[model samples]
Target: MRVHHLAALVLACCTPAAWALESFVVKDIRVEGIQRTEAGTVFSYLPVKVGDTLDDETAAAAIKALYATGFFKDVRLEADNGVLLVVVEERPAIAQITIVGAKEFEKDKLKEGLKQAGLAESRIFDRSLLEKAEQELKQQYLSRGKYGVKITTTTTPLDRNRVGINFNVDEGRTAKIRRINIVGNENFKEKELLDVMVLRTPGLLTWFTKEDQYSKQKLAADLESLRSFYLNRGYLEFNIESTQVSITADMQDIYITINIVEGNQYTVSDIKLAGDLLLPEEELRKLVKLAPGDVFAREKLTESVKLITDRLGDDGYAFANVNASPHLDPEKREVAFTFFIDPGRRVYVRRINITGNARTRDEVIRREMRQFEGGWYSTSKINQSKLRIDRLNYFTAVNVETPAVPDATDQIDVHVEVKEKATGAVMFGAGYSNMEGLILSGSVAQDNIFGTGKFVNLMVNTGRVNKTYSLSYTDPYFTSDGITGGFDIYKRVLNTSALSSVSTFNTDTTGGGVRLGIPLNENDSIMAGLGLENTKLDLGPNSPQRNIDFVNEFGRSTINIPATLSWRRDGRDSAIWTTSGTTQRVFLEAGLPGGDLTYYKVDYQLKWYFPLTSLFTLMLNGELGYGDGYNGKSLPFFKNFFAGGNTSVRGYNISSLGPRDANNRTLGGNKRVVGSIEILFPMPGMKNDRSVRLSAFLDGGTVFGPGGTRPELEGFRYSTGIAVTWISPMGPLKVSVAQPINNNPGDNLQRFQFQFGQQF
Candidate 1:
């Protein structure tokens, strides 16, 4: 067979003037010069079929239609005695793709990205698609401040009508910000304005924070911060005129210039409310936490608008809108704000749909919903329901959406979506603590047993000084009203002879307990428990007098029915990663008359977290404990409270803070106090990761017994330290480095302490 160039055939087929042509009736159509393309595919794209009339107009149309399919580089037509022939040169397919010198992203990830952009292996190759892939690779590097990156693309022809594509990337040094200039600012100093920005020049901390790197997103956010800073300080008309960011010729350094207009400071002269006040006018006025003749602050204005809108939402007006129109007087530099309220239709929840729960039952999630079907849509209740569901910790994520029902103005449907996570674990573990030399432990736990929102755990632990065995179960919804019930049985053995701080003695205790949790409100709860335990004490020859006296007073073997009551209020945004909120707990435990002893211990603790900035938080914690015996008996020596430990006072030895005996060992105290202040932030390079955190803390604590010669406040010690907490694969880990600020003579010291699971 002889193949002729299609260019000449197309030229002769379309032009009737170049060659003589006569219209003929086609008998059949045949495809030629196709290696990879099928003969049927050519016929499908052809406009004319077998037995159709063939002329200059029909032949030109057929030739043009074949080229439009993009399956061939050229197309032509030939007529052989009332038969038409179609020839097509198919485009080559991509056989393989290779990416090299890509250190920032995985090769497979880069290839996947190219696949989405329409250039990948086994796909027909096009020059335009190849160019697009190159730009995408460059754009990804540009996002990481790599301005000096170079990308080269190569295409090689291979056998079997296929081609190979390669992308070679050169990722150069990342650009850094050398200086930042603020122009046209009069009211605020340059240093103050720079302090508020996330982008900055090279500094001591910039190496870890990477704030010195140039990023378009960071610059835009910094400009917005400047506008907000001025507006909140009475600069009502502040504006960012322009921002100019320039890079060095070598693309290694960046300079940013921001020009801002600081308008005159304005004061509020009057305020008014207008338009459709569904609630009482006086009632809405009280919601405004601003006053007349105050500085015109945008922050305050935004708050007032939100208050009114949220109040309306609570009243079932889910689509309410509150707009503030400001009246300005240039001469007096005063502005008056008028709030316009528009309460849309009062909507009701028509249906509640739950989805995305594979292992969990629908009833388990529905029970946590405060918003129900056929109920008026309340924003507060919906928000509370989300929080309650999150607190269950049975799912990785939970989301709710309220979409308006079609053809209904006063009805909507609530859609709840949840992503479930594994809630069961079986672990074999070993840990080491500074006080306990070596510890071995094992546990099996299930937080959502059978998707019914029940909890069960079995644990066994052994150490040089302490050993424990326990089994526990809990039903979060023991009743329909959200009451919690649980029970546990345990046996524990403790020996202080190996410890240097406390008196040398040993105790073996066995017990079982039942507990109940009653919710007083959304943030307040009361917990009560009762249990019976038997303890047998063994005294060593080196025991302190207090321990010996306790054994003589109340026999070596004693039994007690312990009763506990507690109240707690937790308002944190997250129980696991608490960044803001206040928590208070008051706990009391008593040994009742049914057993051999009668004593009571009460503990009070308060913890507060205040956000200092977007990236930092200040936390304060304080605890006080007191214990005493009833019926004129002394507090049990085994039950005394001692303060110093890694969990209490970091720089001091475990249980070392109290009055000492003749052997210079802690005899234990009846009263104790512990307080600490900490600055908390995410660890470097892990700002968005919540599983790890760092803190700088100052701790102070001491214990005092009735026999103490010194005043209650005299024996207090103080320390300062840095601590880190990380959730590792084995278990939770904590490490601290501390320096004792003030320590009395003979007080034990342990400067570095850490606890983490390890295998022996």
Candidate 2:
């Protein structure tokens, strides 16, 4: 009898007994067992309301409707004294989420993932959704080669019908690739195929590059590269059969295998151009890269199509399409290609929209864009505008989008977006040198002050041998015509008493200058400046005759007005780590007739870079300077040139490589020459990084005194070294290790040199 009553209650929850309940009309509806949910919510979901007959189908429909709301765990219905009672047990809401022992991923990132999977705070909890979230968390670790990662979720019930979900994670060690095998390669060797893949077995550089770890994304890219290799090698029907990745029981080792099929080789038998050829057939035919009797190269075929399309775009056809169709002869092992050209209607830009420049003024960026509003669309010009904005160095990134205007087939909008970067810096640095002992410096500068496109800087340097202070300001576009203007004020103090090979002397100089730069063309500019300086020379007891003579003849101090003119042309792809470009400058400085000393100096510098390969660049640099006195006045010793340092030669002490006095003290020279050749490459373990650079260089340079004081030919020095430059978080750092190839006796050698916090 008890079992029969329990079965009747179960049946009553799912459906009512219509024969017994149809006679009873529901007088009122009441809800029970709901802690957070309102009674009206239950009443709204009930199909049979007050004053309506309660039947089996109506009761079943009401239960189904409440369950579909996803807010309840259980629902029950009962009839008592002609009244209906609806009861619901609400699911607990998530009050808090905590992740413990997470290192590889950030806590916020994990929480965000959980939120996307419907397990966030204040959301009704579901056990099935929690299981999916856990599986997803494990998969993320698996993608990073952490096969042994373990995750456990526990819910702690709280007051107000809420629970806290805690995810305890144990991220195990990354699995290392133990072996990689390439199968079914007939023409190519296994080693050849593996060489092109980024993933490799554990090696010397594996820790930094992480190339020994298995990644699905990296594997996909590697497969595509493999396919391209065979297709470019005349295997026209190459395909990847399968790839398998397996891990060991302990999750410490991984093995990958790739199976591929390389079909028969094919050669090009003929190539033709079909369809609408808006230009002359001869003109378009010349752009094709493939020829008869050549191996079928997929890369060349793709390039030919792009070239044809670009040519059409140059002539105001922005929507041109060029397709290549190949006709294959299986038995003959030959292929014929026909390129179909479709030159669509010429489109114009309806508008050019600039956005994302919250700090920089609109005019500051608009002046760099080459694409104009309401102009004929040119792909090259639009692309050039993007590159120009990128080169400004004020923005971290620049992006462009072309969206066709709705209901206007002949017009499109060019949307440009830019992300600004911090252009101001404050730096303090210290370094140790064998000769100078220790040096300290500091600077504060802003390249784009308040987004006005102006520059300002203040610098101070205090060293054992050299001390300087300077302030400068520049207006890049000073006038409406794009002229550049700037002013500088400086004070310098140089003491040579601590040098082993230089005369013991001290000099103080104070000067100020104003300059204007005029642009002649995109790559060329002319700069002119005028300055007045007062220099005081103090000669020690053991000072050289050259210094003593200049001080005795010109008095303790002298004033001079100097005028300078310079022409420069720069075409480098990047100011730092340039790979291809030519830069040249010619500078001339002369003292005016009113000055106590009348002298003139000429300088020339040229630098060129050639990209020898995709990964290697060859660079050449040369500099020459010559100075002489005019109107029977001698060139001031304070203005003489000195060499043998970071900016001149790398293997000798600063300014310690010139003519020597009776005390073996170096005397400044009037002429200087320098040249260097270097091969630049990426640093190890950072194949595509641009912020750091490494190079092997050979440098040769010398300085010569005036008249009969010039040294012998052996005085010229040569050095070979390796150099590294890194744009670290603090600032730019440069380090070089060099050995003098032709070190004569008495030549001061400095084998290693380095500096940090260098200005840009």
Candidate 3:
């Protein structure tokens, strides 16, 4: 009788009758209406036991637990003679997900994004999750300046209680920035302030550069740039008050407004240092670039701090900290600064770890590291080591991090990560040049062979003007002391009949040479080699008198034992695009004993890149060449120096700047002088792209000394021109346009010249 009353009291778990029910023992719990979910799975989620007393609270708890699992859409309880019956209606599982009209991103990518939001295929479908996924998708489009995008989702019920979801998307056009206004600018013009920002109104290059696209990240960066511009120019109290961004109704145009407060400019009243005197106070004071009455520029202060810390780092204080404290006088518009230095404990390298070099041996990278294990940890050494590894060119990237060892304050581990690139090439290609005609070429070269730091190359080329076959090998670590050794063998044939501008001659040369490199220091090296070459000359009737004289004296064919020595100091920051370093090279080639002709030639060249501003670079170059014969032998006419081309004296013809023979033909001179001054900048719309460079140059060169020094060296042909260099997908491309200055009547002036080569 009591069981019947309990069963009757609970019509359903959520009913009011169940709330008034009395406690009763549970006999058996059965779960029904679960198709895809297992009966055992339903039992695991039941919170009540068979022997426990069941009441309104336990029944409600059971329903809440089942619903929380997200596997059921509806859950209820039924009572029958003290037996508990739990019924669940399972949610439909997603069988498949499809996307349509997704052109901005791949369909798989969109599905992946939905998966992150818990709305993937073969998962229990939830309307809330679907809503969240749609919002996330919209955010992605918005980030790309797409203010007008539409997404519609559909649900299709499939067999076996599964459903399919389809999302239709329409990616609209990108919004462009139409107006940018800077308010409250007192000292600088609005245009002047806008010029420093990355975001701008539409311009001629906006289509390619995409700067007209409004982006939140770019706007933030522009604000920071504005802050830096003011802070670096003595406006210590500059502040950006607010910014407003708006889009048009059609979502095609955007407007940005920035409000700023440019406070009083401050000058340095006095400067002082308050820190540990690890170095002499006078030296540290000298490192401070600011003086009394100097404008208070934040950049100057920051630079001073960095210099102090770097100086400390050189002495093994790898974690040195330098900070500045400023004192402001509002009335006088003056500020004073005090630099505080803290020299951290001297640390030594505990171990050097290498990673990410799957093919290259660790020793190849280790050999380039200047910082060794179990040595004093010098920051400069660590930086230099990374630079050296990057300069290897075998790896695409090299990175280093000094992580402190656990429980070891005085020791740190240097972790070097490198990304290896393809260092070998098998090439078969054809190229054409205006001067050299069609050329067929093939090469098998490896800069890093078999996980070893060695180089080997075999090359063959056939062209109208030249043919070459060569093989070479080099082991950079030939000796334990960083000495390098290499050997080369080559046969070259040259035919200059097509080169009407250059002096006419032809030769078939065969030679083999062995060389060694001795490292003078980290940035300097000396290369010495001895070669044996045999040359067979072919001179036509139109050849210069000097070529005739050479064939007559050397009997049409001659053997030469040439000794070559070259000293190079390369301190440039980059070999490809240098900006602020000096490079100097001196080379000497002399005929040694056991040679048919005894002669010597020397060339010296210097290049300096001085950064005049952040965007402008001043480059100065000088080259001098002198060659003559010894032991009563005239200099080899074929060995003479030739100038005047894209490389030197841009307005003149190729190898056309020099003395003339008795027949009034262009004969190359034994002496040459070339100097150039240039201002280089990035190409338009390609800021900081190292592969392309543009420059305005002043070039001057003269070749002389075929007859006498005074008469031959009298005139130095000069030209002012604009040139561009691009490390294009093919090869190095150079174009120049020049106008000659102080023209001579018979000069060969070429106003424009361009050279491009293809490699495969």
- Every model's Cα RMSD, please? 3.9, 4.9, 5.6
- Which residue pairs clash in candidate 2? none
Per-residue lDDT of model 3, residues 298-364, tens digit only: 7888888888887887787888888888899999999998888888798899999999999899999
- Superior by TM-score: candidate 2 or candidate 3: 2
> What overall lDDT goes with each candidate model?
0.84, 0.83, 0.83
Instruction: Report residue 68 deviation for candidate 3 (angstroms).
Output: 7.5
Query: Compared to the true structure, candidate 1 yields what TM-score?
Result: 0.89
Per-candidate TM equals 0.89, 0.83, 0.82
Candidate 3 similarity to native, TM-score: 0.82
- In lDDT terms, how accurate is model 2? 0.83
Of candidates 3 and 1, the better by lDDT: 1
Clashes of 2: 0
- Tens-digit lDDT track of model 2 for 113-161: 9999999999999999999999999999988889999999999999999
Candidate 3 colliding pairs: none
By TM-score, the candidates rank as: 1, 2, 3
The list of candidate 3 runs beyond 4 A from truth reads 1-129, 155-167, 426-442, 498-504, 575-577, 612-621, 643-667, 673-760
Cα displacement (angstroms), candidate 3, residue 620, comes to: 4.3
